[model samples]
Target: MGGNFLQSRSAIRHEVGQYIIRNIFASSGLSLYILVDTVFIAAAGGTFGLAALNISLPVFNFFNSLGLLFGIGGSTIYSINKLKDPKKVETLFGKLLLFCILLGCGFAILLNLFPTQILTILGAEGQTMAVALGYFRIIALGAPLFMCNYVCVNFIRNDGNPQLTMIATLSATLVVVFLDWLLIFVFNLHMLGAAIATLFSPLTSLTVLTFHRKNKQRQLKLKFAFPEPKTLLKAASLGIPSFLTEMSTGVSIFVFNWVLLKLSGNYAVAAYGVIANIAIVVLALSNGIALGVQPIASREYGKRNWENVKTAMKLGIQVAFGLACLLYFILVVFKTPIVSVFNHDHSAKLAQIAVNGLPLYFLSVFFASQNLVIMLSLAAIERAKMAFVLSLLRGYFILIAAVLIFAKFFGVNGVWLSVPFTEACVCALGFYFLTSALKNKN
Candidate 1:
């Protein structure tokens, strides 16, 4: 499979590119379901319910970061090494699967031990605390399923059966939505129903992905193997950028929640929640494009095919920019309608805050997404150091500085502008490193 993609001509390359993108696009159905989930929560539980869910997002992201760290990191290495040694591919997959389960369990234990403390830290209080804790406890129990499902899906995709991956994702989306309606609307379980719906959805993904084992072209194996410290470290180093890229969301959201709570109380947080959910769709599109090209680029580089590497990166950037423009226009033109969808009770103040913030906030996706693609490109080629720097700068350091400085000066509007400013800075640095890394190849 590696040789086939690596050796394919323009026609096949285009097909491969489209195939990868379609699979990734389908995989993002989780975000779509999240959008619907938010709508349901807002309709049933109101602004405070929405706020509670948003507050709990950081914890969910923390566990998700752990999954990406192992899933992507190990898959990157697996893509490159599988062309040279098949046996080692199985070993690496085994190690990543094991690590994912351990990390998930560790997170579950932490949640069980510190549920109240974590809820307080997330800015929950009284009614919101009750709602958020209900959701968190149920989600915590599914940590292992979430983490392992993420790892398996990534492995399945890179194993040469992206169709199966796409099918798995779609299955999960259907199951989640159906259950959400049944449990939340029919049964009136409210937050508990929402959490249960989200939790069980991943099991469908895990179940569907198991079909990949029957594929003759599939190479990812789950044969049990003793873990090696060095291999674990290697995968972690490659995957750290993904972890930080994801974890950055949690960290920034945590900061934003605190700042918004300080500035305008629960209503403000609720407004931001609406915007954040919209941002997820945009981010997922960009991620699909970037991740779509990763295996291709990584494989070509492993075989020392520089021209193919350049082609993949160029295609990814073009698609990201195109998608970004489309998303921005949609947000600007339909700002009011979009806000109203999640605003539920039609609070004028909440609508005003979110509507005013959406334009500037959505613009950030343009540069921020391109930067993410470049960061992933660097990581794919084994330029881990440059990738790490880019992730750290955008995901944490620059993000923190931009949000604080902008909020202090621009007030609420500044808070909205911080994301683009941070991305612009990182996008510039991303190009610099991309140029340097590509130049070194010459």
Candidate 2:
């Protein structure tokens, strides 16, 4: 090529690098803090406490996922649009903000009103039922804040303010960790304290959000607008797949929890909780790595820069494998100490069982990483249907099948083993879809 070609390539690479740092730093930091905080809470609370927290986590994550749908789906679209039509970006942001707020309130009311019913469906029996209800009720109080914070942070990243997003998340997490210690340990409120601390996290995040938006948001004003039925419809259409992908996990977790509780007892529930809890920590980091790849892929796809998209996928997979390896080592090496951090001897065998199964659980990180790339990359390119298809394969179809078949035959070990098998299957399918899309595009 020529100097012009070389300069353009250099610019693309620079943008990709910035995108990577911002995506990984902001997402990973938020996930790590939350994961660590969960582990610490489990440790402080004991078997029942941890089980209750674990039981309730899927519900909380589901709500958070709603935020992900509008915020992330909107942000990606918004970013691509700004690259071309900067003036029209506000329409996108305005609609999403409005829709998310309404949905947030709706979800809050539904969850609060149906806490007992929801917990019962999710396998709450005795104390597990009580603790789940307590935790759920408190967190339900902050639903509005939770939804708003999602829009704010994702928008910051969309606006190319990763540093601000990182700082904002870190501040909220740091505050939650401190408050968690004081409320759960010093005051001994158990699940109630955990719930309050959970509420405080989003509140702190919202504070940072307000500060960030007040200063930097010139493109999109956040005033309350009457519900735009079309905006909510569009968001739901574009975002539903992502929303379902996460919602499926909540369903899966309930199944997983119920199965474990059935196969063993409270100890088993607590043990599996340890594994699930740690998995969240790793999954969050993996998500960070994958999300870092998203903007690069999205921006490149916008300009039809397919090679960078492919390379970024490769890089994200490598990062995911590297992270999984690190996590595997910790599980194998420090399994006892880490498990101890969550529970004592009551869960010793369960912890060992978890350690035995840790590597298997992460074996598909490479594939999982690729699947994530294809999903978001497609969505970023406005291929929402394709994204939904892949999401369904991984989240619902493959995972559900794997869990049932494996768990039926192998028991709890089967439950753990299902992760990789399903991930590999869905990833292969995702690859097929991505290749077809590329062929059609080219």
Candidate 3:
């Protein structure tokens, strides 16, 4: 019995590790689409360009958030039902895909028609408004593509094709990198060039995902089924935590942009732009670990294999913390160089603010990493309400309150500290929820 237990633990670890490695690479590559844009845009357009991109990011986040809402939600359900009811899983893919495409197109039309109003609400003004409009308009055209790609990626990964998903994501990133440089520099398209390049990311990712249909192991079929309101609501309910998780970033950015613009004007917002983009990559790392564990945990839970589910969660938490430590260390030690990479025009003010903010803003990662794993673990075990509550507290309620209170007391430094403070509080809440979930299950 002891020997079997040891072997079981090892097997679970190896399986979890495999998913983690692939997901980390895929998530990191996906994040680079925007990171690359920041770098190239910095070189071509300077601080204003960076600010404009930052202002427009919430829109991008909104697109991705909705996709995850459907993607992760639907995929989690699919994973649970894949073996139990394969036919339901088949219809799920088609229904969600169609709904996402139509929803995305609606957003595209609205954004294109009211670019200025949206940009202004997001804190764009004057030169920033002018620069943002071009990028925003071009990016709006790809809304359907973005939503579809996200939905497909999540479904494919859950369908037991993570390798294909990783390949698709990395390939898309590489293509974006090359095109970002080509369009921004070679064509001197600057902000517009970067936007055009970004459009290809989802296009490339979706194109590559098409090959999943050929995989002999494939189970999901894309047969069109009109989405029933009941089915859509079920998926959305499961996915709300994920939706909030992604939207929290956009919402936080919108609030931060507004506050920062008020406190110190464009340069401060520019400084924040630098720190926020880096945070995207860090959060992506944490999210990768969560996503890696999600499929395994959900499947195990569906099987009622509590021990295996626990094993996956434990491994995820350990990896998340380890990566968090390493990332913070790198950010602390190499802060200058990292800031410089985004500071092409070399403004002293921008560099100073970003350097100071990097360490403080990043302290949140430790808690944020664990929060992600805990939230996803809850969701995996079908604890959607717990996950949703945690998501709301950390991503919105606690964060918004922390930012306002901290900014009042600490000024700019307080703004930076708000994230860490919020995450720490959420970490406590997440632990309570996770404990309650396990106790109830047992």
Candidate 4:
């Protein structure tokens, strides 16, 4: 088995690359879904409506982060130990599902308790607050499904069922689009309609994943196990990078919303929302590739197959950078039309701000995409500290500092350029850490 696996580096990379592409399609589908949803909301509710959606997003992301935490964390461990200790796979899988439920419920309850306060903190006001609260309440109720779906999808992919994961994600995206059209356009439910459309995704995804659990050839099994403290910590630690990566997005939005609120007005926030929606697609492309490379690298690292690990990491990084460059070109070419999609009224100021901001915002993709792949590779190889540091650098430390300094000096332009600056710096650090580690091994 070891010799066959070692000899198949070319085949492995090809196979893994294909697998990663499928995930890209799924993630891209979801990204398009968000963009479509934004269009619908903007058309129906206009600036205030769009801003409301933006306000609620950080809350959604916070809950989603918790799901990713357990899901990615547990899934990584299961991938590493699947062959060595298969029984532990079942235990970890079961425990993670349980944990997702409990934590998701806790979060939902908290959202319910503090709806007004949360909205206020998210920078919602008056009309935006009213619209945002409606979206928030309904979406919060879906927390359990949301969290569990994350666990199911990640585990299914790592269990050699990437196809199923892709199917589920694509199917859910289609459903969301259909529901958004029907509810928002036809029923005229507006913000509530949009929220309902999104709320159904977790259910759709979980239903598809259930088939994998019942499959006879399934590698991940559901088995009851009392959660051990040590095991739970291990899972959280492994998944922290993913958690931070996600939460950082929410944090960025929060910071951007606050800064934009002060610099211009709610219209600026709405315009930023359009740019952020586009960002969803760009980041999703990178995330899909990173997730795709993770299982392959982890399994090889588990076997001490250093050469295969290097090949996989190199291929993944190359794909990441290639996709980033292509995306930036497309964004530049279509900047006006893309901004118009969300601006609806074609407000010149909104269009100009977004068009000006997009190029600068997009430069981050070059570094950010490679950073995600590298960070995930480090996590897969059990370099959790390194991965965590990368997450902090991009997600928190570097990003926050850059945003503060830039936004202070350059206003909104500073806001746009800060992302790329932070990412470029982190990419440099990632290079040093990755190279030094590889040299030490040699």
Candidate 5:
């Protein structure tokens, strides 16, 4: 009996570790879509290009968030119901995929029709406006592809083929990187080339995901079904936290751009572009860790195996903390070189602002990482209200208020401190919710 217990524990750890490692790579690769774009665009068009990219980012975030709304939410529901109600799970992927396609098409049409109006609302103007228009238009056309790719990847991962999801993401990222160079440099397409390369990202990911059908263990099938209102609402409720977590980044960027433009100028916004993109990579890492814990926790929760659920959460928090520490150290030690990569023209103002903001802004990750794990864990166990509350506080309410007040009092440095302060506060609330929920359950 004792040996059996030990073996069970060991098996849990091994399974969780495998998910974490593969997801980190997959998530990081997904982020490179923007990170690599930032690098090449900086080289191609310099400050204006980088600043324009930042201005246009909120739209990209919106597309990705909508995908998560359906993908993560639908997949979480699928995971919980897959074993108990296999027939119900069959139509979920189909319904969610149809929902995303229709929703994505609507966004694409609107964005293409009113590029200038939308970009202006996002704070793009002057030279940045011209650069953003071309880039944003190209990106808009790929919305369906992006949303569908995300939906497919999430369901595939939960369907017991995380390895294929990892392969698809990494491979697509590699293709985009090469295309970024070929289109942006070789073809001299500049910003347009960069946007074109980005379109290839979802295309490649989707193509690779097609191979999932070849898996002998695969259960998910792409059956087309019109979404039912009741089912859509349920999945949306489960996915709202993830959607908000992502949109919060977009909303924060939109707010920050408005504030920074008033506080400093375009240079300040450009500096923020560098810091924010790096922050995206960090958030992706944290999300990867959370994603790894999610399927396991959700599956165990479905089985009513509370002990396994707790164990998975505990392991997730540990991994998040360790990775956060290492990431912060690396960011601080190499701040100058990192900033230089984005500051193509070596503008002193851009350098100084980004260099100073890198460490201050990144200090949030330590808390942010744990918050992500807790939020996702809460969602997995069907404690979505708590997860939504944490997401709102961290991404919307607390963050917006913090940035506004901090910038008013401390200027740009205060702007940098706002995220850390918000994450720290949210972290406290998250622990309270987690402890209360677990205590009640146990």
Candidate 6:
């Protein structure tokens, strides 16, 4: 079990692909539950209910920042372990476990104390505030469980059992969907029921996975002692880029929600919710591909396999771009039909926005997705600062600037256009850095 894994490619490929497929099911199922949950709530309580859930989007994503500590830090260290040592892998994993526990507690405190204030800041309105606040508080109570779900799956993926990771995910999704129907519909629990369902779902999944370690040939060491002084910080620093990139995406959606709310109202927000649910499917598939490549990129780079690194970059981008193009055609060509599925009454402004926004959104999605992959690839190979910078540019700074500048002049339309503009600029920067890095080494 402690031996070299490179020569184990024949077995690894079959295992990894299975793992990717399983995780894909998990992402797909979870996304579907979420879409359905919002739809069910809307039918029960209307757009206020939908907007209430939308308001919590940022907070949910921000919790993901905490989970990423293990995803990037522990996983990267684990992947390169054969080149380093198993003991170091054990230590890193141990330290990350402690990190998740402490951080999850901190988030629980923060979220519990600030539900209404935070929702207000995210642009929840007069009527939306009470509903959003109630829904958020209920959901916030489960932050620890949610964070654990993230850390566990990421660790399992790094543990060389991607399939188990996927199953754990499916278990969570199945449980959540069933419980949501019971809690929300049968019980008339409404937002509270939905929130509780979300909370208990992942908790159940985490519990089910505990039994799988009995067959484990590879052992992950857990240390109860305080991590070596800088280990926590070092691991977190490696994880920060991933943390920030993803969390900032939450901020982007938060902003989009606000703009959409003012521009087209709650109907638009609900329509956007449906559209976002669809996009999550794309994001999920893209993520599965990223997971497959991350460990390979990390390990190969450690061995100075520049050719493989370059090839992986091309292949990764090729797959992502092709997916984006396919989605673009679907949304662009079938805009009315897509919007009609969710609701068609009143000739809603939201339907028009969906039709307009989908095409523009995908224009730079390929670039954005590919750029995200490159960022993760660099990070996996222990190139933290560069990855961090690229993440910053793509996830935050440049896009914010573009959105602010154009949105002021263009109003609602300006906001919609910001995505492609920001993404194209970010991709140029990624290419520049990659080119320069290659030149400098030569």
TM-score for each model:
0.96, 0.91, 0.99, 0.96, 0.99, 0.88
Runs in model 2 deviating more than 4 A are 2-7, 213-218, 305-311
- Name the 10 consecutive residues with the lowest summed lDDT in model 4: 433-442
Which ten contiguous residues of candidate 3 have the minimum total lDDT? Answer: 25-34
How displaced is residue 286 in candidate 2, in Å? 2.0
Q: Rate residue 181 of model 5 by lDDT.
A: 98
Error of 4 at 202 (Å): 1.1
Query: How would you order the candidates by lDDT, starting with the best?
Result: 5, 3, 4, 1, 2, 6
Q: Which residue ranges in model 6 land beyond 4 Å of their true spot?
A: 1-23, 26-32, 344-347, 435-442
Across 93-117, the per-residue lDDT of candidate 5 in tens digits comes to 9999998999899989999999999
Name the top lDDT candidate: 5
Off by over 4 Å in 1: 1-9, 12-16
> For model 2, what is the error of residue 327's alpha carbon versus the real structure, in angstroms, after optimal superposition?
3.3
Question: Could you report the Cα RMSD, in angstroms, for every candidate shown?
Answer: 2.6, 2.4, 0.9, 1.9, 0.9, 3.8
Model 3 pairs in collision:
none
Q: How much is the lDDT of residue 205 in candidate 6?
A: 68
Quality of model 2 by C-alpha lDDT: 0.71
Q: What does the lDDT read for residue 428 in candidate 2?
A: 81
Tens-digit lDDT track of model 6 for 135-234: 7887777777776677766766666666676677777777887888888889998888888888866687688667557646545555555567577677
CA displacement after TM-score superposition, residue 19 of candidate 3 (Å): 0.6
Q: Write the per-residue lDDT of candidate 4 for residues 271-384, one digit (tens) a residue.
A: 899888888778988999989889998898889888778888898899998898899999999988888878877677778888899998999999999998888888888888
By TM-score, how accurate is candidate 1? 0.96
Model 3, global lDDT: 0.92
Query: Which one wins by lDDT: 2 or 3?
Result: 3
User: Which prediction has more favorable lDDT, 2 or 6?
Assistant: 2
lDDT computed for candidate 5: 0.93
- lDDT for predicted candidate 1 compared with the true structure: 0.83
